[model samples]
Target: MDGSEKPPRGSAAHRVEAALLEEIAAGGIAAGERLDETRLAERFGVSRTPIREALSRLAAQGVLESGEGRGMRVAQYSREELAQMFEAMHEIEALCARLASQRLTLLARSQIEVAQAECKAAAEAGDLPRYLRANEEFHLSIYRAIENPYIFEIAADFRRRTGPFRAKKFADAGDLVASAESHDDLLEKIFSANSNIAAEGMRQHMAASFLRVLAAN
Candidate 1:
């Protein structure tokens, strides 16, 4: 789950899970990286049970697969598989953009604009970690504006699956700035109040992003 679909607030296992999700999304953890419960426990200052539980949840969600011994590794997909997943993500995000444009509110616009400002600022400052977090927030704000929980969950799941993959495309401040700037046109279309236009804009945006990821790969 992404930060948006957080598993309750205070469960130890969930805490570990959430933290790991952010680390993975931010590219701190590489694809197919192996994780051991004991190491995770020590890193998080928690008992092994919670580490086990967290890993189990990730496994259940297909984010991790069993590795050698008692370890688990991050799920990594072949290029063909990633392309297929990106195709689906393209459609879902377009739908989300459509709905968000149709059902936009003042608060949602404010939130998106604020998130984008932070994203641009972080990129300009060459602060990758902050930009990653802000990027996630920017999309989450858009997802929430659609006012559909099921769609939000679907979008969030896709984001989680592709986060690490997408993170690879940004290797430096210039790359991050380009990504942040790309959002400007999309936001304009999303705020245009024309659902078809918004959807098409998002489709184009996602197409460019997918191509970038492929190039990076």
Candidate 2:
């Protein structure tokens, strides 16, 4: 039997880093807003050492810009940069879907179907968070079905980085409905075991989402 999962407890540095990342994603720390280590340390009830470490890691991740005297600021992206990021992710995810279609086991496909049902129920109930969680589970089910650890890792990372922004776009009712339809199409293609069709379907789904983001912005 599956045991109950314990909650995560982060170290001081990790707490600071997570809070800072949340601020950035929420737009509380606007693009180019300077990060003051002292202020952040105090706010997070941590020391300067952890704050600095957090800032350094964020800078390395391209989430912040660091300079000798200027300290750090939230990273800014141009429209072109956003487009490029989404385009790269589209290609990667398409490949993932293709592989998943070719290799998905019956058990994995059943899990994906269950996730989809949950998503539909969430939508019907107007539960945004539940819908989002179920949506992620559905995609992840497909990723695991592919059985390529490296590909799954890369796709998961990319999805995590973009998730907050994507969630914002899907807050609209129309977008939510459209997204459900897209998932249906994706699942159908996968069920048919047509890797090429699945790849194309995944690409189109991502393209639609990217367009929605662009339109929102």
Candidate 3:
């Protein structure tokens, strides 16, 4: 997918959750800010039940915190927690790149290439939103290339947790250019079917992201 397609109606809950998560990541909602269920329910045009479910799911995933009388708030990661999460994510995504390199079908590889092209175009045009979405699709394309549902799921979960930091990093021109170059290297390694190179490349790619986060704080 090119990242513009909407999720199926059957998966509306997931779509809602993703939208809310993106808002939080983009700083539309500040960290530690409590989310009112009724307000969100009205805003999203969904029932309180679904809003509650989505909030609880995010809380379980460590993207939100829920407790006595405070309701749900955007999660605030300590520096230590952020470091650990980024390291864990780097390791997992590195493995995914290795597996994807070895397992990618021609179709998957082509799809990733297309996403990369779109991301490059968006970046060059300074289209932040499009660039962000295409960037996400580019990585998801790699996860899909691995053809392992569990690996894809784990990578996505890690992404959700780190989305805010990632978005902020890419807002910098230098960081966006560096990220695009890393995508070029990653794609080349995958194309060559060099799993080790792909793994290392992916690790280095995420290392930059982690560094950016560290540099920010």
Each candidate's TM vs. the true structure?
0.94, 0.71, 0.85
Task: Write the residue-wise lDDT of candidate 1 on 95-169 in tens digits.
Answer: 999999999999999999999999999999999888888998899899999999999988887887777888888
What digit string (tens of lDDT, one per residue) describes model 2 on residues 49-139? 7777777767766777864586998765666877888999899989988998889898888888998888888777777666777777777
lDDT of 3 by residue, 1-83 (tens): 21233334656456677888767644456567788988988888888766776776677667888645959887778789889
- Where model 1 places Cα greater than 4 Å from the true spot, the runs are 1-8
Per TM-score, what order, best first?
1, 3, 2
Output the better candidate (1/2) by TM-score: 1
Among all candidates shown, the one with the greatest TM-score:
1
Sort every candidate by lDDT, greatest first: 1, 3, 2
**In model 2, what lDDT does residue 69 have?**
86
| True-vs-predicted CA distance for residue 58, candidate 3, Å | 1.6
Model 1, position 65, has a per-residue lDDT of 82
The Cα error of candidate 2 at residue 33, in Å, is 8.6
lDDT of residue 160 for candidate 2: 49
Q: Candidate 3: misplaced stretches above 4 Å?
A: 1-14, 22-30
